[model samples]
Target: MVSRKEVAERAGVSVATVSYVLNGKPGVSEQTRQKVHAVMSELGYKPSYAARALKIKKTNHFAVLVHYLGDPFEAGILSHIEHQARRHGYFVSFQTYHPEDEERFLQEVSGRIDGVILLGQSLMPETLNGLRSAGIPVLSIMEPMQQSEWITTVDMDWEAGMTQLIRHLAEQGHRRIGFMATGIPRHPHEQRRQAFRSAMLAEGLPCEEEDVLSGGGRLEEAKSAMKHYLASEAARTCTAWIAANDLMAVGMLSACREAGLKVPGDLSIAGSENILMSEQTEPRITVLDYPRKHIAHIAVDMLVAIIENKQPRGCKMESRLLIRGSSMHE
Candidate 1:
């Protein structure tokens, strides 16, 4: 392994100048920095992570917490986050969130990572407080169930998105609309469900209790729920359906097809988080685009700012309706 002294000799700069350039400090001139970097690259002199961490008191590692790895929406956001983190000279670690394992997870990650980013997990207030007390910067990519000053959050205007979707369905002459939700407690599903109700009521439409079904955030569960809905006499009145996510929307589509119902003819369908699979269905789904890449960049940027002791405010991005064949009733 070539040392910094050798890089300095090859570049004809002092050892301090080489150190300044490698650590991205301000003491070195741009020309000198470039020369030092070129020499270091030619010599393949990689800086030791342990040495840098010891000098700067930072690990350059971040952890992201998610409910599970199966959801494509979360997976897409995670991929973007990994890319952005690498650009910022940080590495990402992923962990599945379970309320039962919260304490143990926190204990293990304490002092190991510079910050934590939460991707739509419902964590206890005490857990958040513990992290805050330990001086760990946390940024949540979803609106937290419990608001805390210690944590920054980035999310979308879900109510506005739902209102737009419901109004579009109403304009297409669909008065009786049903909603499919994830049954997970204290999750963002509640926000979308409330938005659906509010939008329906705003349009003077009837949103009966029976019209709302829980699918437990799984494709099979959503299929089962849709089957049950189809068996009920009330199903005859529902002319459209909106799901909390694209996965459930796809499941509902399968159920509708199996029941001999043609999409947009018998029942129009829409969903949130326009994942890749949504476009591959027989009749592509209309959904609310959640801006996954923007959310990921904002979350990572905010967490990085917080790690540097900068006061960064939480942000909310906008969602737009992506009209497609599934919701275009003639």
Candidate 2:
């Protein structure tokens, strides 16, 4: 009901000043910007997004496609992305990926949003090409399953993180270390697996095929896999285990309890991503902090750059190791 004119008049500023402040344009001092914002809030003036989109040719909305919306790690990252996007005057729409509907989903979101943010979902080449042709920038929060120049990624250095975890375990006198890998194929998972093997070899430890258990990246799946591993000959020889993520590590902890194994005393455990639940579990899980806020900031900033026709670049962030109860040996 209230218009920019009313807000400008009440604030004793020009309508153009109100427009500049609302549109996030330059040339307004901090003092004037604050005053205009206060007047607009008091007057309950709402900008017309449709008119702004028509003038700027931008929807100012971004679509985030997540692999699993229920997963704590993904959900945490989404929260950060939403917060960062809001600071830039943009809104985020979240959608879970369905393999069968990839094409239709891409078609629907191609031009409706200014850009797309992918959270560990691998898009088909055809769909990616379609988005690229449509001039929609795509930024992935993790390494893509397949490499494409069109997709700018803001990813963590999984190999480095895995290597650090392995080295830490080795330093703690854990030579017979095992890895819990995800059953599903993903770029980061594969990188962690390879890094585990490489780090073991570098430390002069054995990394046999049997030492790598497929946890399937879920709590139940990881529990099942760890239970099976606990009954195997390889489990008897292994002294430490590293999971691909914190959820899987929690499952490993549950399996350890069920099997009457004491964490760090019977078998040391570590995980990646440092999800919130990691700390609540008994003998809280040690994990690599994935820097969720930093990744979100980079992804949103890169997407904005791409939308502005600027040269956007991909970056690899490093994870910090959080030493916790589970990984400390007695």
TM-score for each of the candidates: 0.80, 0.80
Model 1 root-mean-square deviation: 14.0
TM-score of 2: 0.80
lDDT of 1 at 163: 87
Q: What are the Cα lDDT values of the candidates? A: 0.81, 0.80
State in Å the error of residue 175, model 1.
1.7
lDDT of 2 at 171: 83
lDDT of 1 by residue, 1-330 (tens): 689899899999888887676555566666786676567657855455445445556888998998679888889999999999998999998987777886897788766888888888767755654454345667887653645544678877887898889989989998999999897778767778888899889889999988888987777889889988898887868899999988999999989999999998988999898999999998999999988998898888887877765667888788999999899942
Top of the candidates by lDDT = 1
Using TM-score, give the best candidate's number: 1
Please give the range of 10 consecutive residues that has the lowest summed lDDT in model 2. 44-53
